[model samples]
Target chain A: MKNIFTGRDIVSDKGYITKRNIIEKSLQLFSVKGYYNTSISDILAATNLTKGGLYGHFASKADIWQAVYDEAVCIWRERVFSGVRDRTDPMIRITKFIENDLRNYLGADVFEGGCFFLNMLVELSGQSDPMSKQILRGFVRISKLIQAWLDQAADQGLLKPGLNHKEIANFIVISLNGAAALYTSTRDDTIVDQTIEQLGFYVRQLKA
Target chain B: MKNIFTGRDIVSDKGYITKRNIIEKSLQLFSVKGYYNTSISDILAATNLTKGGLYGHFASKADIWQAVYDEAVCIWRERVFSGVRDRTDPMIRITKFIENDLRNYLGADVFEGGCFFLNMLVELSGQSDPMSKQILRGFVRISKLIQAWLDQAADQGLLKPGLNHKEIANFIVISLNGAAALYTSTRDDTIVDQTIEQLGFYVRQLKA
Candidate 1:
């Protein structure tokens, strides 16, 4: 059978749309109520799909959780990370990554429901599930992005001699995630702005 | 009815112990699995309590969650905040609060599972439950403690002129929480130490 998602089959277009619909709706609920609190019935109710319709699209709640997490990471990479990738200057690149991607895209606006990756980290970190592994992989990816930039900047002699790039990257990631959590609770935009500002100050202090 | 918790009967002492047992065990699970994922059955399994015994103590999972939250906050305040309260110097108090209460008590060792307050904040914020309200109150209380110290430090002319105490307090709270979340997943002791060290640097930069 041709898949409607790929326009390969007109017959299965409805099936593809139905599956996409379920995933979209599930992502909204999972990001807000969380994966555990968000019940299958909640997905059905929100999607206005009967039990059969919901089950037809995703076999189980866990299946939909995987979809949601994958989609979230994809969005962060394509929507957020892509923009920050083109800058040639490491300092400018890193700062923009923090300001645009970390502070703006991953901040309260795109994730007003809450950061899916961070939510997963808090909710599923220690569990030996595929979900936990994927979340950890995302952390490593982001940390490497920051560390690479810091290392490049150090090579360019913009930063002080003997700077610990990995430690600095960890500091930035820890602070950004922390800021995101605080902003999620308080809905205080200042926290986000202040985090970026403080991070900038830390970087400037490292200048040669 | 005479309360077993009040030692009205020998049988009641068992009841009190049973109730305490449920809360303590639930705290561990909730810290990791979170409130929603942690089913009553999980509690029964961990505590080896019968369905009726568990139900007798907590009407529902929500009830046990409320009790756990209250107990977590109480412990943080009494055991964590109390030590920081006794310091006469605002600088010493704030520093000790970061090192002793925050770094030692609420850091990785005590919160290897997850930070109870932060876990609740991430899981429950914007949910409109009494639990969410209580968690927000805890954030406010901690923020106030930090702000009070910053304000005093500024008044004592120990800080750089024209400092925004509220913003600084917000920074520290955000960073501490961010550090906690990172440590939860990585189990990296350096994250905890670096968080304290970075916080100290922030404070020293504020000093006159």
Candidate 2:
């Protein structure tokens, strides 16, 4: 066997088009019905792809799930990091990052399905899925990203001197995640606005 | 044709005993596997009950879902209210309520599944499901409870005289939910501890 189906080429190839379609449809279905609620048949119905077609790319439902999660996390990291990267001020960059997230997640129909990582947090809290571990690792990665941003801001004298960086970082991340949860639950724009305002207040408080 | 199925009677009866058992088991399953992932057969296997026995109380799988949700919400309300009712000082009561909730949710293996409302919120964000509506209503009820506590605390000179009660209440409720999200995702005790600390700090800021 050639085993030509091994890496990025697998996803980049035309033959793997079904795999990409499966991931896209899976993201939509999983976002709507959730990871557990969405069946293989549901995916098949959405994509009009046969089981063999799906199985050809992924080993099992869990394999497809891991792919969907990886893709979602990749998108979130790129969007969030790129959104705030150009700003010189740490506070402004943080705010912009949050605003960008809100706009993407709550602004339009783009994320009317809610944040994928947050959803996984709820759906896989106690479940022993490899995907669950991946989700937690994603949170740590994101939290570290936020912490790094805050550290830069502090180093530049943008944030209050003596502010506990790790604590504040955790606070910001948890608050943002909480805000996302509230927005998802209410499907109300007000929650997102309140979150924005709260973040603003916290940012101001960070100034000397 | 007696229509003798009173909610209480059915909940307490023998034949309906298995029905309730099935619902409880289904809740665990659904919470873990999600609504679509767990089938009737899965429920049967979990509860060791036959189809006829399962259908004795619930007319269908949807009925079982509704019953499980109702039961979960009822228990959550009791837990929240019980925590709130014990303290006279609104601020202290609110703190205690959150503390109790954190203790209960984080301590127990069962609630480690995350907030049922939070879970459903993500699962049904843009969809029209009776369970979704019910979850939203539950959030409203919780927000109202927080508002009432804030009002009472203000009256008792526990809160700042001119604080926006509704907004504060909203922030608190949303933050608490967010905290629940963080805890559920990370399964870290520190998240809950940090939430309590931040909440306590916020409450102190509200003191008259």
Candidate 3:
């Protein structure tokens, strides 16, 4: 899992811990302050690391950003699929995924800014760069995951045979992203509660 | 209405035109590049204005952001409400508002990024600042507008008497913001087309 990272020559335990610490601090900064909004100084301030000390671990701000972003995605994946990843039932897995997304991913409060990926998706989508393309690919991947679940459900004779899986998957993605953006800003519970309930109903209605 | 803006002491036509020109140029930069990503240098490069010339028109980058953002909202409001703003039929107004939102507002391609407000909503909502509050307030205002239309439909005997207007309005806002975010990045027409059709069906299903 590459949980341990260090300079090539410095494989000391302290160096590995320092590198991980830098990533953890920078994740909070990037999640809330955003990519461009977060300055190198912010990371330094948050991590209490000098430029030399910080650079000893990462090459530059971009290097730290990549490390932080990767870690955030790891946390998000673990949270969103904690209990349901190993489930046997496709329908129950789908339900648990949505529940984990609402109560665990967006509701985890791990990052100060709520869902790190969605915030990045929103911010990066505005810019034209490889990162923007990366964010879109991430959305497509999640959509595909949901579609696979729906297909499995259909195979299990639970979902309708003629329903469009891609459309439904995209719709679910939109709803979850909307709920995160709206709930994070408004701090309104109904946004999350209603979305969870409505989406459950939407998926259940697709049953054969 | 505020097509013309002038400095307190300089009401010259050249100053008025230059200020408007700056606003127009900055709007494009902020729309696609985002609030924090767009630097004063980018704005200057786009406008070909000296630092002095740019500062003469607006007090600071924050001032320029406010001007640029306000102009974007003005354009958005006009685009979303152009045909049905004064329409007498509440149901038709609701339908047209959704249509305009999908085809006219999000689909207008007025801003380089897509929906200016939605992008800002996603970006600024990540940062805890006055701008975030303003963005949430803007969402609420839109929700209230939709709720008013729903209420009007109910008053006119066109909608169910006991439907929850606030939830529906909030759901519509979430859907539109989601649609704009998804469509802008993916450039997928189905995001908008499906939203328009789904929302229309959703509203129609509320009949008395």
Best by DockQ: 1
Candidate 1 residue-wise lDDT, A1-208, digit = tens: 7754675776568778788888888888887888878888899888899999888777889888888777777777665555677888888877887787556566636654667777778877676457767786777778788889988888888888976777777777787788777777767677777777777766677778
DockQ, candidate 3, vs. native dimer: 0.48
What is the C-alpha lDDT profile of model 2 across A70-154, one tens digit per residue? Answer: 7887777666666578787877888887777766654443543677777777777676556677877777776687788889887
Model 2 chain B is weakest, by summed lDDT over 10 consecutive residues, at: B1-10
Alpha-carbon interface RMSD for all candidates, in angstroms: 1.5, 2.0, 1.9
Worst 10-residue stretch by lDDT in candidate 3 chain A? A1-10
Model 3's lDDT to the true fold? 0.80
What is model 3's C-alpha RMSD? 4.6
DockQ of all candidate complexes: 0.60, 0.49, 0.48
The sequence of per-residue lDDT tens digits that candidate 2 reaches over residues B129-174 is 5667787787777778888988887787766577677776777777
Candidate 3's displacement at residue A45, Å, is: 2.1
Error of 1 at B159 (Å): 1.8
lDDT of candidate 1 over B1-208, digit per residue (tens): 5655664876777788999999889998988888777888899999999999899888988888889887787776665665677787898888888886556666636644768877877888667457767776777678787889988888888888876777777777887888877777777778877777767766777788
Stretches of candidate 2 off by over 4 Å are: A1-13, A16-19, A50-59, A153-163, B1-20, B110-112, B126-128, B154-163
Superior candidate under DockQ, 1 versus 2:
1
TM-scores of all predicted structures: 0.86, 0.82, 0.86
When candidate 2 is compared with the true two-chain complex, its DockQ is 0.49
TM-scores, chain B, all models: 0.89, 0.86, 0.91
What's the count of clashing pairs in each model shown?
A: 1, 2, 0
